[model samples]
Target: MASFEINGGKRLQGELVPQGAKNEALQVLCAVLMTPEKVTISNLPDIIDVNKLINLLQAMGVKIEKVERGTFIFQAKDIDLDYLQTEDFKNRASSLRGSIMIVGPLLARYGKGFMPKPGGDKIGRRRLDTHFEGFAKLGAKFNFDQQAYFYSVTAEKLKGTYIHLDEASVTGTANVLMAAVLAEGKTTIYNAACEPYLQQLCKMLNKMGAKISGISSNMLTIEGVSELGGCFHRVLPDMIEIGSFIGLAAMTQSEITIKDVSYENLGIIPQTFQRLGIDMELRGDDLFIPSQESYQVDTFIDGSILTIADAPWPGFTPDLLSIVLVTATQAMGSVLIHQKMFESRLFFVDKLIDMGAQIILCDPHRATVIGLDRKHSLKGIQMTSPDIRAGVSLLIAALSAEGKSVIHNIEQIDRGYQDIDLRLNNLGADIRRM
Candidate 1:
């Protein structure tokens, strides 16, 4: 029920440290179920989703000990699979999409798993067909009844085979990877999702004695081993947060520095933002965005209006499409924003339009934004958050608006960004969490 009150039109000038990646942390936490030995994770983001996952793991009898604020030591020594059948587990598990990932690890380790429908950003039909399909290929049997998904694999020794995913679904690939790590034979996954999150998952699994190649590529070859041992790994910095900060700095004309960013991992982020005429200087592992009067939206090489779209990894992330769309509203030129991954994501543009942004929501998947070029600033208004990315988009818009803006459903934002209000406040943004 909390809201953010932002006094906008102020230049944010300071250094901001990015937190650990939320998406990566979710997978890493689920990976703990792969082993009964203690696994220590450092640099974990203290976000709501991570906390929820940790609580869920603990409820399942995983020994979760906080080593520090952003570090934790976990051991799923005595997993209670029966917990998945309770209403508490169902309610919490259904609140986040990452909960679906537990199915594979639980089945691999415990030989059985059950979970109710998982929940996440209601942008599109996030199907579990890919996940179920991948598991079936790995000698797993599944049943769906009474609004719950039940999966079991009777094969004492799981033998791996080639798996061509129906789609390059991120969680689907991850589930298959988790299951294949301990199978009897080798597993080859083609058309896999090689996003940074998945890459980190592969790295962590390899560290634990699972043989995996093609870390950042679509085709992954996993040589299933007898068992995985415990290992310590640090979660990667939140790239989505880094992208969000970039958009925030651009929209507010802020001079900000993002610290401890892995520059090499940022594949197409810089180039994607460059299309909006926003440039940043790379200082070692940090990114410095200086305050600017206005940004220009570049046109296509043929002098046509530019279009920014999202794709799988090596392409622009769909998660950041909302950020790019919101940032474009403050730029000088016009551009088309295409969100191919989700249908309802662009529907939130109506909120931006109400804030004086010249946006045409062409459909559920596309929007055309004409930048105000600092000649006009968005006036503050009360709005509701639709999802995690869209909620952060509203926060950026609120931060750049001329007056106070109230954004409800702060839980949506909390699910992703960690201490967002506090972090932005450090950069001199006049925002209060109410």
Candidate 2:
């Protein structure tokens, strides 16, 4: 269990390039299983989760060639189905929530898929019901082994049908979409998640000879094909990391330039940070955050308190709400952060409260933050990272605080961010891995 020893109250400056999207990487890596031809992927983030998925694919007999640092060519020519039932496979797959995605491509190509109960951040109850339900709607028989905590879906041949998802779950939509691409007929998915990552997946699938339409809408149409071929794909820059950098800049009063951010794809993220009074400008696909003496939060037009909440696509992302809450601690006004998707995400505010931020944890789903406005610098203390996003949030708070702070369980941070301590240290941050 490595920890971060941070010397707080240091201003940083430099150009930071965001890594490839982790969420999209997971989905695309699984998509490689649907084709036997060479599928080339670029801009893959070197993070724990993505690397784990790559290793899992390799274990399943996918031939992978590293063309460059963030580029790989994968050919799933000889996948070993029997490996899925092994204890080693179960132990590896059970540790990654992204492993659930493998079931879709496996079912599409092999007519059957099996997985141990997947694991991920302990943020909340992230159910796999949507994925299995969508599969069941598409003519797949689902079974669960309660004794082993395993799930399996099998089908002789999947026939596409209309599916109105109960929730616009991103991974669920991706899973079903992957399965539908190889089904026998047209599949229409209503209430689908239209995130950029999903759109990227659709585009890559289409390039691989799968027919898909409604690129950026709630409803998607997929025409089942005989088979899919390989295609080259590049993942978008991680918007969550971009949002984290924005918050870090505001919290530390630093001028930082984030390079090649795929500015257009970052829906409402920049504006949301601006709503928190964090000034940022677009400089030809890059985001420039100037050092701020202080920022002010905005209120509703009718003079009500400002509220930021997460919803399906086009709404603020729930992943960044933790960063927003931590960033708002130094703003000039107050804002309510409602984490509608997950209940326990707001529980991290207690650590911030200990760091001298004025936050009211109204409930498991909401928090109200009254900005200290830099009148008093936060005093760092020992803390443990709860999850990936919250870990980065606490790191941001510690960077802007006074005195020394020790952050334990930094493995959580490493799961998402790539070499976070080394990257931040390059930007003049005092983060030492101990």
Candidate 3:
């Protein structure tokens, strides 16, 4: 029931150190269950989803110790497999999408695994059929009950095989990678998700003795190994937060510098934003966003209207489309945004329309945004965060609007960004967490 009260129309100017990648942190935490030795992860973000995942791991008897402020030492040497069947475990397991990944490691190490339906953004129907399908292909049998989804594999030894995933689902790819690492033969996953988060998972697995090739491509080759050892790995910076900061600076007419961003890993993000006429400078590893009065949407070379769409990794991320849509509302021109990954993601544009934004909801999957160009200021109003990315988008809108705005259901925002209100406050934004 917490909310954010934001007084809008302030120019933010300061330097911000981005936190560790939330997506990678979740996967790395679950990977600890695959080994009995100690695993140390550095640059961990202090966020709610991570804390919840850590609590779930601790409940299952994983020993976690804080080595430093943003570092942790975790050892799953004495994991109690029985905890995975309890009611408390089911409730906690169903609280986040990252919890689904535990099934692979558990089933690979232990013969069986059980978890309830996972929870995440309600943007659309996120199916676990892909995960189960990939697991079943890897010799795991799946069963469902009224209370939870149960998975058990009867094969005495798992034998790897080729898997062509139905879609390049991020978590699905992670599950398959985790399961394939301990199987018997060579496993080739075609049409995989090669995002930076997945790449980090691959690197960490290699550190733990998993033979994985094709680090940043769709075709992943994994040679199953008998045992995995412990190793220390550092998680990457949060690119989604970096994208959010880019959107915030453009929307509020602010000059801000984001520090420690992995410039090379930002494959298409920088160029994607440039499509909207938001130019950014990379000073070594940092990103600098200069203050701008208005951004213009670029047109096609042939003089047709520009269209920006989301695709799999190496393409634009579906998660950042919300931020782009919201930021485009305050830009100088018009563009079409197509969010192909989720059906319900574009439904939040109605909230922006209520705030006097010029948006045309073409359908559930696409919208055309006409920028207001600093000529019109969005009026303050009460709004609810429908999902994680949309929550951050609404916060940006609230911050760019004229009076006071209240954003309810901030727990969704807490799932991804770390201390968002406080960080924005440090950048001279008038945001208070209430």
Of the candidates shown, which would achieve the greatest lDDT relative to the real structure?
2
Question: For each candidate, what TM-score against the reference?
Answer: 0.98, 0.99, 0.98
Kindly list the per-residue Cα lDDT of model 1 for residues 1-434, writing each as its tens digit.
99888898888898989999998999999999999899999999988889989999998999988989999999988988777778888888888789899988887776667777888888888888898788788888878875455433344556799999988888899988999898878899999999988999999999988999988999999998888889999998888999999999999989999999898888899889988999899999999998888889999889999999999898999999999999999899999999898888899988999999999988888899999898888999999999999999999999999999999998999999988998888878888888
Sorting all predicted structures by lDDT, with the top scorer first, yields 2, 3, 1
Query: What overall lDDT goes with each candidate model?
Result: 0.89, 0.96, 0.90
Q: After superposition, how far is residue 74 of candidate 2 from its true place, in Å?
A: 0.6
Task: Please list all clashing residue pairs in model 3, or write none if there are none.
Answer: none
RMSD of 3: 1.2
TM-score-better candidate, 1 vs 2: 2
lDDT (10s digit) by residue, model 2, range 336-377? 999999988888888999999999999999999999999999
**Candidate 1 regions with alpha-carbon error over 4 angstroms:** 146-156
TM-score: model 2 vs. ground truth: 0.99
Mind sharing the TM-score for model 1? Answer: 0.98
Point out the higher-scoring one by lDDT: 2 or 3: 2
